[model samples]
Target: MDELNLENEHELLNSLETILTSECNLHEYIDDIPQIFATDNLKTMSHKEETNGENIETLFDKFPMSSNVSKDNTNEIVTLKSKCEELHTQIERLTKEKEEAFEEIERLKDQILSQSTYCTSLGAVLGNLTWRASRFPQIVDTWLSNFQSKIGEFLSIVNGTFGAFVDTYRSAFPPTSNVEYQFVMGLLGIVTNISASPEGREFLITNSSGMEFVQKLIKLMPELPLAPGTVSLKRLMLMILYNVSMNKTGLQYLLESRVEDTLSHCLDDEASSEEMQLLCLRVLQSVTYDLDKPKYIHNLIATIPIEKIEIITSAKRSDISNAAKQVIKYLQHSQKITK
Candidate 1:
């Protein structure tokens, strides 16, 4: 009886060892858990043992404990555990990214709201198309068309001076526009677009008061106070003259006015910006273009440094180099004159 009990105990130990070894190799045996377990021959609870030479053979083919997990089920459990941990880490990372996305969204929403409020206020005050929030530049173009139709009335209101025009323009933008620099910008927008057109160029030349208007602006240049507004105003005025000097009639007026010397001085001016220097150079180019007018050319060569002109010949600005090259080309073939 004791020998039989010992045999049963030895068989139980072998079965447990076989089950543990099978668990270790579970991954090699399993891919799909449910299908494998369903179709497989499950172990039964009936006694299963074979002995030879006092040794009991216990392996998966013979072990019978129905509750014990199959190789496929063990592998599936390990894979499911790994997948769960990966999902947990991904969820944490996604949560942080979602928080950052919401912060950017809120900042953009605030910026949009602030701009919307500003545009709304601008709309309520300036109801006319001339002063619309996005299209205010259209005001000058409209002013140019109107001025062309009623030149005398337009001249009368400003009284032939830019200062008067500036004062009247402030009423169009009103105190709410809040930018003093817009004054010069408003005036520039009108003349710049007009000056670019052939029809507009003809109008300025044919209109009896056109040169008179230009002369008044030139006369105004010397008298401008050395203040911020005046400096900007002068720059815009120079730009107007540069555009006007595109044709011979206008070029003749500049040479006859003897603005060449004044323009040469403007090139040397430290207070004025490079844009001012460029316009001054362009006007000089126009004045010197009439080879018939060598007197103005002589004055230009005398006052401006030859090296300075050379420096402009290689200037970073395309417009400056273009005008400077014209002057240099003109000088290369000119008669010898004492500076």
Candidate 2:
């Protein structure tokens, strides 16, 4: 029994030594923690770290210095700066592109504004003359053959009456009576109405007169800043000239005159309306209709652009739209003949 107590005492002494060694190791671990925090270069740490050192307990509570967390944050900052620079460059490029697009749009708007009147107002005049011709088919036929004597004697109005109409106008026009302009429009309207017909075209062509009256009528048209009466009279003259020019003889007659230059001068008239401009275009179409005449064809090609023509083809008025379509057709025909 004595031997058993001695062995048990020996075992108790060994267990006590083990307990003391564990206590020493724990104190060493606590002592090393502060040194690790003091030497670390982590910049995101609080002001306490920069001033002195953090509390020993707080040093362990935060992310560890050996975890590579600070390195990862540095990489993230660099990437964000690069992205900011790239975005700034993209914004500059887009601003330049937008400015260029706005300039192009302004140029296009100017082109369309110049042509808008022809597409809208000219259509009404063209439709009116066509309607009148269709309504009094027989009368137009009789008048076309004997314009001065047949219809002229009946109304006491004749082609020579246009000469007197111009005499009523002066250099200035603001105080002019608006009612007197109708007589000029009426006489010319009847002539255009008659000329627009197929049978009427035949009379103008076959009659010994053959637009001799029209050649004289063109000379009487007043120059620009035109009185209202002169403007109405000239518009009628253009319509008559356009109808006459639809034929080979009329085309030949016009090519021989300064009418092409006259039409250009009329177009340049600041006082000219869209209806006047449209009549000018119709006359141009007839004059340029002679595809066999290279001079006329070249004149047309030089005078108008394909894009401008394409824009007018969409005119809100059907007569203007149809006329534009016919103009485009003539242009295409001219192009093919040239090629």
Candidate 3:
């Protein structure tokens, strides 16, 4: 029994010595290692330590240091910081440019306001000159020559000023006054002559911007207390209507407004007079000839009292007889179609 115990004791000592030598070698290796860590590897080691309560410092102590990798990371951080500063500088430059553009817009607005005020003053001065020149033919002729000399620069200004002046002053004087009638008639006659020109005809048909003004003048016709013996306002109105009727557009308006209804009232009670009959015939012929439609002619026939038709039929004059016949034919045609 003593001999067996001695052998067992020797085996136990050898195993203890082997374990101590391995522990000493591992310690020497760990002490020689450096302190540098990879970011990715550090994250993994941190997770393992949290889960198992392991020491991360012991694992990281086995890795070696690298000065080259440390220097590269520091250089990357400095580059990113410099780029951010350049972007801030660009943004500041753009902000100043925007402020300068806004200031320029405000300056232009002030200049435009000053120019508009100056134009208004000049317009008033030109309007007085036009009104004065219109009173005397010799002065008007001279003024027109001067106007043509500066046509390109002042045409638009002249038209606007004179148009406003005429609108304001033309109605102030009575239509029966010889001077007023002459002024109004002379202008209308000139316009009519111009309208016959090729350029004027093209302007009237294509542009037609003056149509509203013509309609306003038509409405003012009844307001003029013109005596037939003195001024013949009716004749003048007829002439105006005939001129405008050259284009069917204005005639369509007269038809729609039933302006012909007023014609019978203008006829004198003394229908036997040649002048009265001729005037009545002319008005009738103009309406029927221009409109040339059954319905419009029927409306005119309806407005004339049947007694007036009887008077027209019994009239001895050939002109009056012809006018009555034309009206009767239109009425007959209208009734036949309605049936």
Question: Highest lDDT among the candidates is held by which one?
Answer: 2
What candidate 1 gets wrong by more than 4 Å, as runs, is 1-149, 156-185, 303-308, 311-322, 336-339
lDDT of 3 at 281: 56
Q: Judged by lDDT relative to the true structure, which candidate is superior, 1 or 3?
A: 1
RMSD (Å) of each candidate, 1 decimal: 21.4, 26.4, 23.2
Candidate 2 segments exceeding 4 Å error: 1-135, 142-157, 167-180, 205-210, 220-224, 298-339
Sorting all predicted structures by lDDT, with the top scorer first, yields 2, 1, 3
Query: Model 3's lDDT to the true fold?
Result: 0.48
Quote the lDDT for 249 in model 2.
65
Estimated TM-score for each candidate: 0.47, 0.45, 0.40
Q: Compared with the true structure, what per-residue lDDT tens digits does model 1 show for residues 1-339? A: 233367767776776676566545443333333332353222210011112101222343365644344557546545644553454354445545656777999999999999966764553344232223213445444555765666445433323435554554433433424333453345344444555555555566556666666776666565544455555656667866877788667777766776755776676667877777787787777666635446766665676745677877787888888888887766644534422
Instruction: Give the count of colliding residue pairs in each prediction.
Output: 0, 0, 0
lDDT by residue for model 2 (1-339), tens: 133366656664554454345335434533543443454322322233223222322322432333223455435434533443453354445445656777899998988976754543354365345446645777666555666455434223434555454554545543323434444455567667767776665555455444556656555443534556456667767877887778676667666664656776665576877787678777767766536667766665565655666776786877666776787788788878877
In model 3, pairs of residues that clash are none
For model 3, residues 221-288, the per-residue Cα lDDT tens digits are 44434344223534544554555555566566666666665456555334224555555556555556
Error of 2 at 53 (Å): 99
Candidate 3 — which residues are off by over 4 angstroms? Answer: 1-177, 191-210, 226-230, 268-280, 289-298, 305-307
